[model samples]
Target: MDPWLTLAVVAGMVLAGTLLLNAIGARVKAEPLIAIVRAGLQLAALVVILKLVFTSMWLVLGWLFVMIVVAIVTSTKRIGWSREVLAAAGTAISVSAIVTVGVIVVTGITGRDPQHLLAIGGILIGNVMSITSVTAKRLREHLQESRDEIEGMLALGATPRQAAARFRGLSVSHALIPTIDSTSTTGLVTLPGAFVGALFAGSDPMDAGLFQLVVLGSILFGGAIAGTVLTQLLGAPKVLPQPPREAEEETAES
Candidate 1:
């Protein structure tokens, strides 16, 4: 496709989506517009950077680090920038991405091409970031809502970990729902981007399907690990502090 034509198409799509969102009274405000513009700028920058760094392993690693930092910063906006939260998200995403990508490389499923590595790594990291953010946000919200129940459990001699276990489980499960639903409906409801992109690049149907399967599996694994780790980290007593009885009573009186 011509570059100008592609740009026009993307711009049109963004505009249409923004209008539709406004029509529906969505609370996102100007985020869609901002995100679309930001994504275009970021992708343009990435294209230039990737062209320069795709030939060197060290450069590729540096680029991946940049991507991880971006992911962490973006995630911290949704899930607070607390030390434990950052540590949990960073550890979960890094470990799962490394393990998943390592398995793909070791098994010869994907080539050692730096471009391929960066593409796959970025996808894995992005998915994990979303999962971790969702888990953290949901866990905090649940903990806040279920404060009474948690305090009751605590009063009954249950540890903080034990008290928060149910909420943690729920949060992790909620975080993984999108991945689970996508996996369950892959062929019927959705033709994933990886599969479609592979086919567009002239890959065989079987090869494209295999690649998509790998991508899907990696996302599921990474998301699960990230969500679980985040929930566990957030479940700590220090992280999810209980309100004092006096304060609770005072607030109730107010």
Candidate 2:
């Protein structure tokens, strides 16, 4: 990527940051100029690092492992359940990996190249990691926030499972929105990375389009299962874990 182009991308990302904060009615505080410089430096560092890492099989595997670890950490950090997060992440990833590899196995009958296999696996794993993280975090937060309503249902003789079921629905659906929108608006509203990247790599339009479609459908299918698993894990912190005390305090203060 060109330096100037990278600057433009950073600018666009900062705009996205502004929009994200503003969407929740948060004020758009001016981000520090050094933040952009630091981001540019980090991008340069990652590019240099990845260049060295991807050249060797051992290093490539190491890089993928690091990415998975980061994804696991990312999922856990966004939510409060410390003990269960790792377990939830590992389980979600395991289920997702099996499903993804299975899909690739079917694709293998058509004889995929090593490159295609790596690319497809990377895409599937990354999306599933995201889905898992988002699902678990949302479920935990919703359940905690809605604790009173949930317990009220429990008081009315609902089981813990029954009490938390509504939140389970809300959180999972909310978590799946991005995947759904990406599927529905693909090609029409936006060109996803799989298609655009394939074309950029000199694949034919039809071939690139097919690859994108297949990957998108596979993600939605596998993500549905992966997301559900993470949500269920979140639901089971103390065999239906209660919300963090901080969350309750924040809600009360508000």
Candidate 3:
């Protein structure tokens, strides 16, 4: 692809994304412009970096590592930096990324093609980063929110993990909905860009469908693993703070 064309595409994406952000905010009465703008800047910067990375194999691998580092740091911060939070997010990203890329290369599914390594890495890393971020954030927030109920469960003799059962499971499942919906309504409710682009590139409908199916299925499994595993790790009974018994009972009396 021409460099100018790539630049144009990035510009178009920023324009469209900005408009969409505003529309969503207006509809929901939620102001997330700063959040959306920050995300746009990060994605735009990533596109520019990818252009550089694709020029050489050394840079390509370096860029991949950079993506992992950025994702880990961001996930850690977003989940409210604690030793356990960092450990869980880091573990999930590393495991999920290795699983996704290793399967593709080891099985000769994608053939470890250097020619398309950058493109493939971009897709995999992007999805894994999103999964890690969402899962980490959701787990932490849910854990904090359900701290009282969880302690009550523990007081009732439930194990720590058992105390977190409902909130942990619900939050993790909720985190997977976007991925699940995208996978479910791929062709009908929404034609994914990957499938559309494949057809535009002159691929047969069957070929495009196959590729999309593979990518979507892989994302679901990888995302489910990333979300569920990290949720369990961070939501494990030990992360729950033990409130003083008098404090707890005062609230009960009220």
The better candidate by TM-score, 1 or 2, is: 1
Cα lDDT, model 1, residue 199: 90
Candidates 2 and 3 compared: the better one by lDDT is: 2
Model 1, which residues run further than 4 Å from truth? 239-254
Find the candidate with the highest TM-score and give its number. Answer: 1
Off by over 4 Å in 2: 5-59, 109-114, 156-158, 237-254
Residue 234, candidate 2: Cα error in Å is 1.9
Q: Number of the top candidate by lDDT? A: 1
With candidate 1 superimposed using the best TM-score fit, by how many Å does residue 173's alpha carbon deviate from the native? 0.9
Q: Candidate 1's residue-wise lDDT over 142-245, tens digit each?
A: 88778888888888998999998998889989989988999999999988998898899999999889888888888988887777767776675644544456
Per-prediction count of colliding residue pairs? 0, 0, 0
Instruction: Please list all clashing residue pairs in model 1, or write none if there are none.
Output: none
RMSD in Å for all candidates: 3.4, 4.3, 5.8
Query: What does candidate 3's lDDT look like per residue over 114-213, in tens digits?
Result: 4345555566666766877776666656766667887788889999888877777777687888888888888789888767877898989987877777
How close to the true structure is residue 73 of candidate 1, measured as C-alpha lDDT? 77
Q: Local error of candidate 2 at 91, Å?
A: 1.9
Model 2 is weakest, by summed lDDT over 10 consecutive residues, at 109-118
Model 3, total clashes: 0
What ordering of candidates by TM-score runs from best to worst? 1, 2, 3
